[model samples]
Target: MSDKPLQRALGTTYRAEMSCGDLGKAIRQAATGPTPGEHTLREARVMQASLTAVGKEIEQQQEPTIAQELRTPVAAALADYAQDTGEILNAVNDAYIDHEDDGAWQDGKTVRMSAPLDELIDVLRALSQSPDAYADLRAAHVRQCAVGLAAVPSRAAGPTYTAPGRNCAAGLGYYDGIAEDIPDSQSKQWRSDVLQRLRNSMGTPPAYSTDPAQHITASWQRDAVRQVKVGGSGFLTDDSTRILDIWATARGDDLDARKLDALQEDMGSDACSRAEETTKQLACTREPSKCP
Candidate 1:
């Protein structure tokens, strides 16, 4: 009934757009005081450790699934929540006389209880309802991959082995546009140079990906083409880097198996079969497991 703006004694303000019960609860707690600190700081610390342990374990998985990526943020939020919760709990004890005033209740006031927990809950909800909730996380990861790819020293500016389906060429083109918005000028040029080099040597037109929308070969041709490419330069350029980067950023990994297949592709197959021993050695240097 008081017209005074409900101020948080901890001096933190939450968003005004909370759902029905949340806004009412905030008002009621502000009018009265924080509930007696039930859970101790030790409990909150334990929760923090657990969440951190879980997050690290999840991160250790090789090339995470979309579901795993989504869960990644949730673990981070919960860990942060536990940390903040511990602070709040510590600050709400009997001796915490800092913010006491006339209207303050016996238990004293402290930071908002739900701020961090609300963040964790929001992440969980977004996982189910919001498609773009983790776009920034994915975009950041894509940018890292692009930068790493770009940083690779340019080849000796001479002829290199070309794959049958131009899979490596197409892979380069696939990431050209994806990296278009990247800030570094050199990073933007690397893929283009590689793609152009391949196109020039491979006799143009069909050397690039025909499916611009898909940015690669047709779905039906993908398996066979990727196989041919894998046995050559395509394994490193296409399957190992570009495809994995884009698919991870887009929250899908449709061709994950192809990555393994590329690694296992016979040295005596496809374009590699025709390549000089020096070229084959170069490829093997990039991935020792593929060496004959």
Candidate 2:
């Protein structure tokens, strides 16, 4: 059945999925230059499905090690996709639930500030012991911030006043603190894509200081000019369908557009003024204020 060629093809597909290789862009480049056989996201999924069947066959034959080798990367990629979906849903739901009561007890400054500090300690510990884990953990954490903050819109567009949380600016600052060792090569696109969303999501006044990349100055400007295509590979593209799906679930799967608009309006400002350090804004909007 010529299984050797098929196995090599599947291996190529596996690597593409692992690296998040983009086929459309690859094809465009191929017209003028080298066209490496990179699989698209859809092709990768099909390869993964086929691999799953092959993995089961190998497992049934008691070649468990072979099966594990075949399946682990695919499993890890799926896990990444799942975790991304969950984070997006949570951030969106926070924005979706707009109300005065919702703002109460919603103070997240201490929680936000403290957890990252502790994680930083752990990352430092991992510096010598587990370098790969250190890089991977920090990258995922940074990615989480980009996705989570991007989902929050602004005070004008919808509910920015979630109970107990840092504002978008604070979150970005926290991200910047931990991301120093992380390379711009690894973190830049995810950061840029979500930060770009911030430009419009906040409605007219815009919630943040500037496009977050502006904080990077020269590198930031380069990124803006060089951004290619709509959406991106890896976590950048994960939100495309995930956001709409979770939004539907947030609305109880209701397709009623008017109801959705009403839902956003009803969320109200009830916003927590999370600008604690600047002396620019109060930390708490609700009484019994705990923010600081």
**Model 1 / residue 259 / CA error / Å:** 13
TM-score of each: 0.20, 0.24
Model 2 vs. true fold: TM: 0.24
Query: How many steric clashes does model 1 contain?
Result: 0
| Decoy 1 TM-score against native | 0.20
Taking the tens digit of each residue's C-alpha lDDT, what string does model 2 give over 1-292? 1234223434443323332223212212221112222334433333333333333333344322222232233332322332222222224334323421121122342100011122222222212122232233323333443344344443323344332122222322222233332334655554444344433222221222453211222222223234433333332222222222333333243245564445433222111111112112111211114544
- lDDT by residue (145-204, candidate 1, tens digit) is 233323223231112111212222222232222232122544424333423333332311
Clashing pairs in 2: 98-267, 106-163, 106-164, 107-164, 108-164, 108-165
lDDT of 2 at 256: 51
Off by over 4 Å in 2: 1-39, 43-131, 156-208, 213-292
